[model samples]
Target: MNTLAFDTCFGACSVAVTWATPEGPRGAFRFERLERGHAERLMPLIADAMSEAPFDFSALQRLVVTTGPGTFTGQRVGIAAARALSLATGAPVASLPSLAVMAHTAAHQLKGETAGKTLAAAVDARRGEIYVQFFSGPDLAALDEPLLTTPEDAARRLAGRDVVAVGSGSQLLADGARAKGLSISVRLATLEPDVRFVPEAAIPTDFGVPRPLYLRPPDAKPQDGASLARVS
Candidate 1:
């Protein structure tokens, strides 16, 4: 199957066009790291990724996207693009969690003895907190609900565990754990979710239609006084 997958749920905007063949899975992708401008870059990145292997949008059978515990603007930009592309191409959009994507990426990158270790994925949520989750293994079967928490608090909860932490919050979480005399390892300085794995992540699960997965309420609130009157 030819699939178009993309993620704009964090500091990076990434897109990939992948095919599942008898030989194995193969694909190409574009990844750009930036704190802003995801809206401008995501679509073009997707097009570029597809064109790399001469895959057309019409050839896409599925659209996989990261539904996020990420930046508000980034999350909205990704889901909207996925939904619109699905409608235009008649491809089913599969929504996967960004945190899980990170976990899997970390797991795949782990070497030797670390390969089977427990994983902790965390994204910097800003304001001194992170979007954190624990997984039994790389498949990211959740050991707990994704939580918005301080690094210290997260470390406390996951203390005494041998965990390979990934994502932007990895360093902070690792440091916190070490300070608390717990065992934790940092896999990378940052491991933003990869769109290349979005398809794999979706295929094995009941991936529903793409939707924004903001773990907490948005910082922006509605203006009740400016609201239109209710029709009913």
Candidate 2:
């Protein structure tokens, strides 16, 4: 089976195409970090990665996308692109949580015994809060519900626990944890979700319409004063 995965839910834009070969399953992936402009760059980047794999969209069996707990605009960009491609190609779509993708990446990177360590994935929410989640070891099982809170509150919740923080918000979370006298076994602050690892979070049987996983409501709201009354 051939699968394509892409993520634009945070600071990075990534794409990957995985296909089965006689030898084994193999993939081609492209990832780049940017402060903005995912809308402009994502398509070209995906094209590049697909070209490397030489995989055609018509042959895609599955399409996986990160339905974010990240930036609102970035999340929309990814889902819109995926949905459009799905409509054109007739491939089934799968949703992968962005935080879970990060956790999976962290767990996959761990070496040797990782029995008691928690994998904490976080993304900066841009108003001094973070989008966060926790998972247990390489299995990446959920340890808590997805959360949006101040870095300090998040740290307090994880106090006395051993963790490995990974994501854009890792440094801040690690700092908060240290203030609470918590132990962080490792910190991977520079890491961004790679689409190549997204398959780990894909739910084939639970497939449904993909949507942005915004834990908090949008910051911008329509101004009531400027709104005209609806014509009845």
Candidate 3:
């Protein structure tokens, strides 16, 4: 199976491509951090990864991408790229939430440390809020839907369970837990999503087109009472 996956939901842009040769699965990847220029950096990064894999876009059998709860513009940057590529190459696209991707990363990086502990993945949604999801058990299955809420509320939502929190929102969750007498251990708190680990099932063969997962209304709104009258 030849697969392509990418993520641009938070502080980074990354691409991953894997193909099967007669020998085994071979892959290529690129990961970069650019909080403000993902739209410009993404495509070139992808092209370079494809070149390194010595494969063409037409070789892709499946595509994977992150849907958001992330920056409004950043979230769109990825979905737009994946959608355009799917249109051009005829490969199906599958989507996973950014927080779920973080959980996958935590599963890999924190390995043994995560034993018997829940995985708490969070994104700093600013305004004193966090985008979070919880995963539990050995396979790290998600325990519930992703959500947007205050750090304190997120802390309360953990229900006093021990969790290994990962992502930019770690400190806020940690602080909230402290204030509420709940506690969580934070790891890879500064990490961004890596396309290399976007959860294998996230790119299933029977896939639908990916879409943005913005949890809240955009911060940019049409100016109040500032629109000119439309003429017929």
Candidate 4:
């Protein structure tokens, strides 16, 4: 399949494009951690990735983007780009979770260490909370949907089992797990969604037009006149 995938679900923006050839699969991608400016960076990154392989957008057979339990801005940025590209090229868009991409990347990169332990994808959701999801057993089947909660709650959700966790929130989860006498190993402590595995991660999830996977309501709320006057 001639597929293109990208992620802007957390602290970074990344894009990947790949196509099948008689020789083998060929692809290219761009990844950077800017923590913000995902809207400005996403399109250019996609263009740069596709240009490396020199393929036309019209040739894309599939499109993928990470819909997230991430920053409100970041999730929208990636989805908007995927929607525009899909509209232009008629390629179907597959929405995958950013944490799943992180987990999938970790599974491939740290196969040895992750062998028997449960895999936990933990993104720092800020405000003393984290976005977490668990995967267990050989197939790495997801044990639950992505969740937004405190690190302590997430650690407790692991049921005191040995776990290998990845992402920026891993340390927090690790600390909480230790407090409860459970074993947790942290890997990729500053990780964002690994764009290389964005497409691979979709294989385990349902596909559809991308939508923001806000695990909780946005922090910013409309201020009423009295509140606005107080701030002023």
Model 3 lDDT, full chain set: 0.85
Indicate which candidate wins on lDDT: 3
Model 3 superposed RMSD (Cα): 2.1
- Per-residue alpha-carbon lDDT of candidate 1 for residues 1-232, written as tens digits (9 for 90 to 100): 7888788888898888888768898888788888899999988888788877656788788888888888889999999998899889998887777887777666666644445666888877878898998988535577887789999999998865778888889888888788888878787667887766543643544545777877789778769788787899
Ranked by TM-score, the better of candidates 2 and 4 is 4
Give lDDT for model 4.
0.83
Could you tell me every candidate's TM-score relative to the true structure? Answer: 0.88, 0.89, 0.92, 0.90
* Superior candidate under TM-score, 3 versus 4: 3
In order of listing, the candidates' clash counts read 0, 0, 0, 0
Per-residue error for 153 in candidate 4, Å, reads 1.5
The global C-alpha lDDT for each of the candidates, from Candidate 1 onward, is 0.79, 0.81, 0.85, 0.83
Q: Rank the candidates by TM-score, best first.
A: 3, 4, 2, 1
Each model's Cα RMSD: 2.3, 2.3, 2.1, 4.1
User: Whole-model lDDT, candidate 1?
Assistant: 0.79
Model 3, runs deviating above 4 Å: 202-206, 226-232
Give per-residue CA lDDT, model 4, range 16-84, as digits (tens): 898888998788978899978999888888888888775798889888888888888988888888889
Error of 1 at 57 (Å): 1.6
